[model samples]
Target chain A: MESTANNRVIHVRELVKKFGDFVANDHLNFDVYAGEIFGFLGANGAGKTTAMKILCGLQRPSSGTIEVAGFDVYKQSDQIKKNIGYMSQRFSLYEDLTVKENFQFYGGIYGLSATEIKDRTRQMLESLQMTTSADMILRDIPLGWKQKLAFSVAMVHRPKIVFLDEPTGGVDPITRRQFWEMIYEAASKGVTVFVTTHYMDEAEYCNRISIMVDGRIEALDSPAALKAKYNAATMDEVFIRLARAGVRSMNG
Target chain B: MRIIFYILQKEFRQIFRDKVMLPIIIVIPMIQLFILSYTATFEIKNTRLSIVDQDKSTTSRALISKFSGSSFFTIASYETSYEDGMERIKTGTTDQLLVIGKDTEKKLSRKEEASVLLVTNAINGSAASLMNAYASGIINDFNRFILEDQGPAGAVPALIAVQSRHWYNPKLDYKTFMVPGILVLLVTLIGMFLSGMNIVKEKEKGTIEQINVTPIKKYQFMIGKLLPFWLLALFELMIGLAFARLVFSIPMEGSVVLLLGIASVYLLVVLGLGLLASTVSDTMQQAMFISWFFVVIFILMSGLFTPVESMPAWAQNLNRLNPVAYFIQINRMIMLKGSGFQEVSGLFVALCVYAAAILSIAVKRYKKTA
Candidate 1:
């Protein structure tokens, strides 16, 4: 079979995932294009995380197709791993390590040279304007700084796609704004952003958002268009309207 | 090349950053190795004896002088009479009392035998038995010379006589027997305890997330963790040995290299046990508890104080499972028997099998789990 290079960084078709007869994802389909902020907007237990786990090669899909960054997730998992970065909700980084050390550890894992890590760290610390705290341990830092530092470490390798599983799950608006700025910087560098989040305002920042309902993508489009099409004022309103329609559609 | 160094540097930095747990990594083992080695012994102490002399003759006095001159006892007190010595036995302070009755010298001259009175404190029974044995042995030696007419030449007066010699350590001070085995137990237990828990801590703390997703192979990561601790165990062994040499003046009778060679194999088995433990544990605290539980068993079964043969037959069989047991045998064989590899191969092979089996299982488990 021939492979096509598309603007889509991730292409899924009829993705079925089961957990011992419990269908977590039922025929899920979505496309995340390159250099775009793809918001996985879904309610709790709507299979958004399940689909993301499959995309990240954490869990095997029961049956269906998954193409992440020109690599088949099932067959070319190692290749998929090389071309992407993953950060979990808990912000997986050595807490005992300093900000610079965490950066070095992650960079080393991704096969970057020490010089590259040093230069990149300089750039990251310079952009954050927190050069003085480069050597400050991550556990000692505030949660806001920790969030930003985690994002920086995840993007340290500059992979084609970065998976942020609710990267800012619990943080204030200012910290959330700073986090999105870091995401924006990564996306501007032509890195595709596949992020899962509960915040409606953050969903608005995505170029395209997919609202999952009952293990399927109920709506996938720009927030403005989804809101306008549903005659709703915001993505939250659009989500509620689509969720209701999705229920009624199921009933019908 | 640079990447592995970066990871190594980060790990070392983190190990040092935890200021509280850091010094314990080095100093605790050293202090323990030095202090505890002195405690691991088979030598019995604080024996008490009561003497009653009814025959106040010079010969009786000369015989009593032999007991008081020895270092094994503190002659608790001298009873005025036989009844008093028997009374001293009830309180258990004196494990045994010797009563020499009147006409003790006349009975020997007349070729008629006279029995000595030996009152024993049976409360702490084993000490009483050993004390009686020593007292009887010294009296028997005195009787062989003084009571018999054969004089000094009687032992070798016969034409067909044999001479014997003592080897390795003739004196066989309990400290010489103890030092090597203690070195094995401490090194094996500490290495197993600390190194096994090291990776388990990383796994619990989620530092392993970076390691698992990295291009570094499982074997490399496992080696990097285990090797430093293996070396540390040996370092402690060397330090303990040096202290034993300088302070206790223990003679290394056998080949030091052979002892170390067997010890190195024994260390592999212990380190493998540690790795197996780490593979099973999910937290440092759990690893610590599990290691301590094994250490207790290891010390008991290693024959650090008592002979493995002297234990129950089932316990002797159980001791075969303990790697520390083989190390102790190898240590004593090398240090006391001055034995070669030929004499110690059985223990070395047992340790080899344990090392290979445990290390293989641990590596497989780590790869599958981590």
Candidate 2:
């Protein structure tokens, strides 16, 4: 399906991925517009990671036409890779490296100049209010700061889209809130945020969300629209309603 | 190029920062160099001997005294019977037994060649060979002494004078032979273990995923991963060489450049093995276990503790695939025998081939995508 939105940064249609006999992703179709916080939410093994991996060009789709950041996934994966950034669920940063060192490394790998790396690292540290911890090793820092730092490093190259796979898996409520604030801050700067999360409450923060159940997207709409369509008062109830109905359909 | 530097810097920092790994990389090799160089030897010392003399002759006693006087043999016991001496050999009380037949002295006086039976427990083949040589030398010396005593009244022309000398090692010091091989082990250990675990640690911590998403090409990433350990292994070789020179006084007969040149390529082969191991394993423990198995096998077949020429035919054939074996040969040739580049070119070319093959395989096996 052609994206109806004016600015469709990610247009994935009929995407399918298989691992031998098991289908990890089944005919996933979605349009994520530019400058939007798009939530790809699912439970464990619900294929959120599989689909996100395909989008990020980390896995080849069995069948699909995925155009990410204006580059085809099949023929232009290198281009797609150059235009996107990724943060995995485990908060992928070198524990032995200092925060400034992590920033310099990520920025350097992305082809930033020495001056650019120095400037960006300085700005990132100042923005995170981590100037005092500039030389502190990542393992010594708190988990919340590390999560935020991971995000900041991912966008150091100013890519067209950024993928965050469960950016806030284990953190306190306030830190999670602050982490989402950084996501909002990035999206506000015209960087499309494609995030995956299992947290139902976190799903409410996305501009539009897709709830996956058993390799299929069961619900794709705004949080209000999903609640209204399922006749539920919250995103959590909407998720349960769709997930249960999905299981019933599979069984029937 | 810059990306490679970043990766190299990160790896060096992590390698130096880990408290446990730092000591293991630096201290273990040095300590092993000292300990293994001292302990691993083919020199036969204090070989226990048991004698059973049935003739009760002066000649028999003279032979026994000759053996007993040598520093290599100790007269552990004098059994009354051959069966008792055999029993002593079985019980580990003695390594060898000499049984003198009853007619041994009578035949010698009658101008007939006498016969005596010698028995040895040849559990260790190399040590047994050395023992045989030492015992034979003593018996020959006794034979000459008897010849002079019997025929000195009339002057006789000597038969022949056979001049022999050990060339490279005149003293036949086991330390000289062992120290170079131990240095090869130090390089192999550092090159394989450190490089293997470095890649696997990123994988275990999920940092590899972050690296995979970057624009770092496969070869660039691999070179970045391997370069630090290669240099580090060379640094280790330098230290080990210094220790060999200062402590063991092993001669550095060949050019230092030639040794480092072979060592550099040899390190590539080992570091490539490490990267290949890392690519196949999912965790640091798995990487370590896999590399450890290969390291032990390679070191054993490497002609370090034993000559590769002396191994079984199939094992010698297998050494063609072992990089450590080639390196041990190269190091010993350069340090001990003063072999030049042209002399070791066959091994050098084989190592170059191995380095290329293993590194390319490592690069190909490392999956940037899931």
Candidate with top lDDT is: 2
List clash counts for every candidate, in order. 0, 0
Error of 2 at B104 (Å): 4.3
Q: RMSD per prediction, one decimal?
A: 5.3, 2.6
In model 1, pairs of residues that clash are none
> What are the per-residue Cα lDDT tens digits for candidate 2 across B303-356?
888778889999989989999888888888899899999999999999999998
Worst 10 residues of 2 chain B by lDDT: B150-159
Model 2: how far residue B311 lies from native, Å = 3.6
| Model 2 Cα lDDT, one tens digit per residue, A79-142 | 8889999999887898888888888888888889999999988888898898999999999998
lDDT of each: 0.78, 0.88
lDDT of 1 by residue, A1-252 (tens): 112455778999999988897787889877777898899977777787788878877678999999999889778877887888777677678888888888887787678877898999999999888899988878888888887877787778888998888888878899999889989988998899999998998999999899888788888888888888889888878877766645423342
Residue ranges of candidate 2 with Cα displaced over 4 Å: A1-6, A245-252, B55-57, B102-107, B153-161
Q: Compute fnat per model.
A: 0.44, 0.74
lDDT of 1 at B300: 82
What's the CA error at residue A82 for candidate 2, in Å? 2.4
Q: What TM-score fits each model?
A: 0.82, 0.94
